[model samples]
Target: MTIVFISDDAQALACGADAVAAAFEKAGCTVERVSSWGMFWLEPLVEIGGLGYGPVRVEDVEGILTRHAELVSASTPHPSSSATIEAWTLERQSPTVKQVQGDDLCVGSLEHHPFIARQQRHSFARAGKTRPLSLVDYTATGGWTGLDRARSMAPADVVAEVTASGLRGRGGAGFPAGIKWKTVLEAKGTTKYIVCNADEGDSATFADRMMMEGDPFHLLEGMAIAAHAVGAGEGYVYVRSEYPHAIAKLNAAIALAAEKLAPFRVEVRVGAGAYVCGEETSLLNSIEGKRAEVRAKPPLPALEGLFGCPTVVNNVLTLAAIPHIMAEGGASRYAELGMGRSKGTMPIQLAGNIKHGGLFETAFGITLNELIHDIGGGTASGRPVKAVQVGGPLGAYIHPDQFDLPFDYEAYSVADALIGHGGITVFDDSADMGAMARFAFEFCAAESCGKCTPCRIGSTRGVELIDRILGSGKTAPDSVEALPQMHNARKAGRSRDEEFQLLEDLCETMQFGSLCALGGFTPYPVRSALKHWPEDFGQAGSAQ
Candidate 1:
């Protein structure tokens, strides 16, 4: 009996994996629904005897099975009467698998695929290999070893191990994870909480959702280790309501792992789809059944959080890396992987207009040029890469000239950019920087929690001001003749120079005056576009 594996990941399902699976099942083939390999472009991917076939349709199933049957009959010394299938399996698992391309039916083994082969997966090592809810599969792959290791040691010893690992938060802020855990552990509280921020609202980021859906046990184990270190009895995963599939899988995994977790129980909390809830305070508030809004930070969540008790709020990826770190010598091994202050592997999601958009986990020193061109395979449109957004919507728009910049937290900060959540969104030459700049302000305006005036008012006013500047012929020249006539009498003839100044002033105000990152970081894209592509704003010399 030939076994077939198809992805049940949300992206795969959206691309019609369910139909493909049903087609295989109807043909009397042994079918198993597995997690996505994150090779989204070739979704509805099916694997047979270690060979990968993708973008498969219901119509293609018969042809695939027929090809396998032919391979089975032709090969010599076949265990299941399939010599060719055995050869392919050996090739996939072997050190040197034949790398072939341009064949729609077979891309060979995904292990040898350039996209999968090059990545140094740590937190996502078990991503595509196991059944998400299978305890047998999870343990066979060394799942609970980390938790067992953490449980044997003292709580402080567990904290020391994590601190030695040099792991940083993967959720935008590059704060050291061990330090946060230490604070929670040392904080004066009897009941502490571990909150996993899974409210992944970023446009190009899906690693969190993938982790929860693919390897839910990995996340649970990581959280349990954190619980042991911080002396917390309860944990909550605040996932956005938009990720129904991830939420469902997490809930199911929690049920299955109830005994494994013991006193350190886990719960799944759903967000109301508010983008601001991605922030720590907002997420904590949402878990408490309060309105999802950012609370001013003085008493950080590590000391005062979750019903006025001490708490450790780490994102999905941050917690997910814990299991690996807790294994023997895993901390030192993880600490040695990356460059400079940034340590361990980052599960960077390559998205937007890219040829191979998926999760690529590697050390932090890889350059944007290597990621975009060498790894990402350049633009999906096959056009010259114009700009790439290294973070989420709030991240700065990086120009082609800056492609050589290393993908490190401190390096990006010095460059006036950030590797926020490791979500890279690419854009081609056809992208309009002016329109993109306007969209940034518009995004801020629409998603603002409205608790602070700078973000709420500044973003709305930014949209109107950019509209006026765009209409004032700023893209061509600053001359009065080039400017369009205003419809309002109050401001009949405002110069483009004045509007530009107003925009600059507004950006400055938002950057400094805003309470949270929503108001503060909105100026990143706006200013980066204005600085790098001043001609887009029609003011070539106006970038400051």
Candidate 2:
């Protein structure tokens, strides 16, 4: 009997992977639903024997199986001869096996695929490999070892190992994970909490969702280890409502691992899809059944969080890395991978108008030039690459001229950019930087929790100013013509230039005056766009 592995990931499901799996099952193939390979473009990906075929449809399944059968007959030690699917997978990795590309479909081993081959996967090591809920598969591939090792050591030693790993929070803030863990562990509180911030509201970021759906047990193991280290008896995973699939998977994983994660009970809390809830304080507020708004920070969440007690709030990726850090000798190996300060691998999500878009996990020193042109395969439209947003919507718009910049936090900070959530949204040459700037402000206005004045008021004003500057304002063109007296008086006025200055001033106020990063970082995109493409703002191309 032929063995088939089909992705049951949400993306795959949306693209008709279920039907394809059903088709294989009907055809007498033993179908195993597994996690996505992260090669999203090839969603609904199906593995027959050891070769991969994707974007496969129910209609195409019969033809694909026939072709595979023909190939197996010609090749020695055929898939049918192999004892099991795992053995078949390992055998097909031989150099003698070659990828076959047809006009109808592309057949190949994912291991040698350019994108998969180039990546140095750590967090996503089991991405395409494991049956997500299968504890046997999890253990076979080195899961729960971190928790076992963590359980063996003193709680303080676990914190020390994480600190030594040099792992920073992947959740845009870039705070040291070990430091946060240490503070939570050392805080004077009998009852501590572990909160996983799964509210991934940023545009073009799905790594968190993917992790939760694909390898939930790993996340659970990590959280359980953190619970052991911090003496926390309870935990919560705060996920956004947009990801029902992830939430479902997590709840299922928690229920399944009840015995393994004794004493540290985790509950899944759903957010109302507020982007502000992605903030640590706001996430805590949401978890506490309060309005999801940013909280003032004198009492940091580590010291006073989650029902006014000590809490460890970590991002999905941050907590997921804990297991890796706790594994024997994993910290030293992980620390040795990246460039200065930024140690360990980063699961950079390549998104937007790019070819071969997916999760590319590698060390921190990879340049944008390499990522965009080499790894990403450039713009999907085949147009000239223009600006690439390195972070999220609030991240600065980096021009292609700066493509040589390394994927490091400090380097991005120096360049007035941020490695926010490791989301790189590529844009082609046709993109309007000024319009993009306006959208940034508009996004802030729509998402602000309304606790702060600058973000709430400044963003509304920013939209109006940008519209006038871009010649889209209501009275912009006809103000001089419609009113003769006003036109005469304002003839000597540098109205456009003044508007630019006012916009800059508003950005400055929002940057400093806002209570949180929601307002503080909104200016990053606006300023970067103005600096790189001044012509878009009705001025010559001069750096501001």
Q: Each candidate's TM vs. the true structure? A: 0.93, 0.94
Residue-wise C-alpha lDDT for candidate 2, range 1-544, written one tens digit per residue: 8778888788889899989999999999888888888888788888765578878988988988888777656663466544443564575575544554333465576767778888888888888777888887887788889999999999999999999999999999899998999999999989999999999988878899889999999999989998998899999999999999999999999999988999789999999979999999999999989988899996999999999999999999988887888888999999998999999999999899998788899999999999989988999899998899988988999998999999999999999999989888999999999899999999999999999999999999899888888887753345554476664544433477677788889989999999998999999999999999898787975635
> Please, what are the lDDT tens digits per residue for candidate 1 over residues 1-544?
6678788889999999999999999998777677888998889899776567878999999998876555434442222324233343454565423433325587766777788889999999876666788787788778999999999999999999999999999999989999999999999979999999999998999999999999999999999999999999999999999999999999999999999999999999999879999999988998999987889998899999999899999999999999999999999999999999999999999999999889999988999999999989999999999999988999999999998998899999999998989999999999989999999999999999999999999999899888887784324333554446733224245677778888899999999999898899999999999999888877768556
Clashing pairs in 2: none
Model 1 residue 424 lDDT? 93
The local distance difference test score of each candidate is: 0.87, 0.87
How many clashes show up in model 1? 2
Clashing pairs in 1: 72-82, 474-538
Each model's Cα RMSD? 4.5, 3.3
Residue 408, candidate 1: C-alpha displacement in angstroms:
0.2
What's the lDDT for residue 433 in model 2?
Answer: 93
Error of 1 at 259 (Å): 0.2
lDDT computed for candidate 1: 0.87
